[model samples]
Target: MKTLLMITGAALALAANPATAQDRSNDRAGDIQFKVLGTAVLPDGEIEQVNVDIVGLPANTQTAASDNYVPTIAVEYFVTHNFSVETIAGITQHDVDAVSGLPGAELVSDAQLIPATVTAKLHFDLGDSIKPYVGAGPTYFLWVSDKPGAATIPLGVTDTDLSDEFGVALQAGVDVALGDDGFGLTLDAKRYFIGTTARWFAGDVLAIETEHNIDPWVLSAGVSYRF
Candidate 1:
């Protein structure tokens, strides 16, 4: 979060500079922007349903996934002065652990996920410097890799898999132009509604099959260059 704080500070500082907003003539249609950002991926990995639990999980079993911070890159194209399409690229890793009934037990480890998304946004022209926007779009979360946790390995578990799924996301953010030369700073937030199916196997036998709600709130702060 130290990186996030710094990004926020820089953006705020730039916004406070009176000279940065001196000109708004360059802000127009057909512009393409690219950004490098520090992002925080906060997810809720609670078990939502149990399709098959032959492993006999605890009656009140529940789980949680760890939050991760990563670097992300975003590309955006202006369809018009007030509309744009944007997408981001990044990979985040997490560990899921039992939080209740079987407290402290690790269920899955080092799950790497790539959130592939595209958003259509409506930018609200608030003034010369601040442009606030809202967006909604579809997202496909791809589970690149995952491993059985230490606790699961002893149960004769040989493999683990998390199903890739598609979902929707809502976004809101502000972009602050630093100068007319097309440099800016942005702070964006997105809420994703997504879920996945998890399976654990012992050689040829399926030990457990469960469904999970992996709703994640993605937050970002970055420097942008427009062309």
Candidate 2:
């Protein structure tokens, strides 16, 4: 929570300064832009639907409520008057659950995910104030720290592994210039079609394996500086 506030404050400080709005030229080739992005992530996919993977266990497990919000930073460098390259980086920690209606039948699991992405962007010539852009690229997800819940220890589910994912990315956004100093506010939406393999443990050993599609849509809003 504190980190989110710090990001918001820094963006506001940069945006509120008069020196940031002095330049209004959006088509300046070779210009470099930096952004502090605040993202609200709603996780939806096949991977998130699975519950317990214990062998010979009763079915009817519900996996839900793992969505989260994340903050990130990005850099954009213009290659031509209307073309640019963009890179974004962020990390998230998800609290997951394996549950059923049977009394006291629940397990908690968590994972850490980091995404590194690069994209080629084409900006529309919409004068100096309204700049709309579209981009497509690739993303690599690094998954780590797949921790099994305490409750699972008694259930013979001892471990888990969430494999890294590779997928394509698509995005669209608009940047609205703030005053004349080149500070801007941006609204961006992106989607990633990432699929991965997961393995679960039973009897303190690897047992169940599943193929999962981690398709996630990311929507973000934030502040940027265009130089």
Candidate 3:
């Protein structure tokens, strides 16, 4: 959060500079912008429903997934001065641990995720150098791989799987142009509404099945270039 604040402050300061306002326009249609960013993926991994409990999990069992930080790349194409389409690429890893009934017990380990997303954005014209945008789109959360946690291994758990699901995302962000060379800074935030089903098997027998809410907030800050 501190990093996001610092980047946002820097972008705002640059946008307010009179020098940047006169440094050539950043309003070119049919242009493309690329960004390299540091991103934080914060997810809520609470159990929404328990479908099967052959292993006899305790009542009031709850779980949470760990947060992850990773580098990401974003590509955007301008359809007009105030409208664009954007997409991002990145992979993140997480762990799900029991936080309530069985505190500190790991239930899922090394879960790799790829969030494939695309958004159509509407940029509001605030000034020549400063642009703020709002966007919405669909996203697919793909699970690459996952393993049953150590705690579950003793329960004769042989495998674990997380279902790939489709969801929607809402985004808001600001971009500040630096100069005529098409370099700038950007800060963005996206909220995702998603869910997944988790299954655990022991020798081909379904030991557990659970429905989880995996909604996440993705935050990013980075430098951007337009061409």
Candidate 4:
């Protein structure tokens, strides 16, 4: 009878240990991450004009650019071991020059704060060193620092009433574990598609509206510590 009692106690202790280990693993499943990101805009389509204003100039003049840069801050919340939700906030600066008309003439040189986006991502583990992810979500843009005097033309950007932009985010990267204590380095790349409208008054003479389609790609590298 004593031998049977000892055997039962050993089985209960073994069961308790696995449950405790599982609880510990669940506690460490979620992670909070921060990343510094750099982005470049790829301009394939023309900047569409919703409105236009010309003082004494011709109405046929329009401006375009080849490329632009956008840098951002990314914050991610891991919901599970291999899934997360991420939010990104960034600023973009563009130098818009009239394609055919100007000799060193800059039409618009300004910085605008891009809207923030929240994305739901699924991460894939490739062996022990590589992890890749993909996500899609909605974005909201807010325009800041519109200075009419800074441009060659007197076109005043009164406000940029940006709407809610729907976008998709794709990301892939590798995590280099530093040690067993949960310190690691991460490098990732992501692309976002965003669109908005710029509302402006041309020197109090005419009101012009412009629609901007911005597709930005982000590259980021950061360190993370898991507890």
Q: What is the alpha-carbon lDDT for the whole of candidate 2?
A: 0.70
Tell me the lDDT of model 4 at 151.
Answer: 50
The better-scoring model by TM-score among 3 and 4 is 3
What ranking of all candidate models by lDDT puts the best one first?
A: 3, 1, 2, 4
Question: Which prediction has more favorable lDDT, 3 or 4?
Answer: 3
Regions of candidate 2 where Cα sits further than 4 Å from its true position: 1-26, 45-54, 57-65, 98-108, 202-204
Q: Looking at candidate 1, what is the lDDT of residue 77?
A: 98
Distance from true position, residue 104, model 3, in Å?
A: 0.3
Query: For model 3, how does the per-residue alpha-carbon lDDT over 48-158 read when each residue is reduced to its tens digit?
Result: 999999988989899999999999999999887666899999999999999999999999999999999999876654666788877779999999999999999999999
* Tens-place lDDT digits, model 4, residues 1-227: 24423443543354345432223344435688776556555442235664554433344445563466655677788787666788877776555555543434454456355656787765554455455555556666555654442454434544333344555554445566677766677776555566655444544444555566655555666676555
The TM-score values for the models, in the order shown, are: 0.88, 0.77, 0.88, 0.66
lDDT agreement of model 1 with the native: 0.88
lDDT of 1 by residue, 50-79 (tens): 998888999899999999999999999998
The segments of candidate 3 whose C-alpha lies over 4 angstroms from its true place after superposition are: 1-27
lDDT per prediction?
0.88, 0.70, 0.89, 0.55
Clashes of 2: 6
